[model samples]
Target: MFHHILVPTDGSPLSGMAIEKSVALAKSLGARITFLTAVEPFHIWTDNANQLAYTREEYERISKESAGGYLDSAVAAAEAAGVAVGRVQVETDEPYRAIIDAAVERGCDLVAMASHGRRGVAALVIGSETQKVLTHSAIPVLVYR
Candidate 1:
C-alpha cells in the first residue's frame, strides 16, 4: 500500500539487488519511487597547516558523477518495470541522516535499502549506514541483505 517508496543506494551489488526489489515492489503496488544517493564530500589536503580548503566545485562534480552512475541503473530498472521514479543526490557526510531526511521530506511511505551485512569487528569499527538509518529514522525501513 505504499504510495511512494524511497530507495537509497551506495552502488554496491547488494544495493543493486535492493533497487531491483524496490522497483518490483513499486510496480506491483502501482507506486512511485524516489531513488536517492547520499554522497560524502571529498576531503582535500592542503599544503598550509593552518586551514583546509573546501572545494565546492570538485565536490559537486564528483558527487554528481557518482550519483549519476548509481541513479542511472535504478532509474532504468524502475522505468523498465513501468514504475514512476524520481532521483535525488544529496551531499551529506552522514548518509543515514540524509536517507531519513529525504524519506520524511519527500513524504515517502516506505524506505527500502540494502545492508552491507558486516559483522563483528568490522561492523563495530565501521558502523553500518543501514543500521544507523534504522536507529534514527521515524518511518519504516525495509532492509535487504
Candidate 2:
C-alpha cells in the first residue's frame, strides 16, 4: 500500500488523468498525495531574437503562475476525495529528475504519472519522462496512459 503518492504533472490532459487515478488509488489506500510540478526556465538564446521574449524574472513569474494553475486542480480533486494533499514546485529543465528527487525528498513510496504511450520512432523522437523515471528511479512508478 502506498502511504504517500507523488504525482508529477505538466497540466496536460494526460497529466490530469494521472491525477485522478492517483486520487482514487490514494483514497483506496488512505494515503496522502503530494503534487510536484517542474517548470522549465526561459530558454537561453544566442541571437538577438531573445530580446522579444520575457526576461528571466518575467519568465519565472509567469511559469510559477501557470504551474500553480495546474496544481490547483489537483488540490481541489484531492480535497473532494477527502485526501490530504501537498504541493511542490521546482524550476528545472529536467522534469524527470525533479520528479524522482521530489519523491525521495518527500518520502513518497510511489510515483503515479501519465504516459503518452508513444511507439517506436515517435517515442524515440519525443522522449518519455515516464520511461526515464522507470529507468532511473529506485521508487516504484505507476504509469497511467
TM-score against truth, every candidate? 0.81, 0.85
lDDT string for model 1 (1-145, tens) is 7899999876777788989999999999999999988765554653422113325575456556766788888999999989999998877667788888999999998999887632211111013788898889889989887
User: Where does the lowest 10-residue lDDT sum fall in candidate 2?
Assistant: 117-126
Runs in model 1 with CA error above 4 Å?
45-60, 117-127
Write the residue-wise lDDT of candidate 2 on 1-145 in tens digits.
Answer: 7899999877777778889999999999999999988776565662323223567677567667878887899999999999999999887657789889999999999999888422211111013777898899999999887
Q: Model 2, stretches more than 4 Å misplaced?
A: 46-53, 117-127
Highest TM-score against the true fold, candidate: 2
**What are the lDDT scores of the predictions, listed in order?**
0.76, 0.78
- TM-score of model 1 (CA atoms): 0.81
Q: Distance from true position, residue 35, model 1, in Å?
A: 0.3
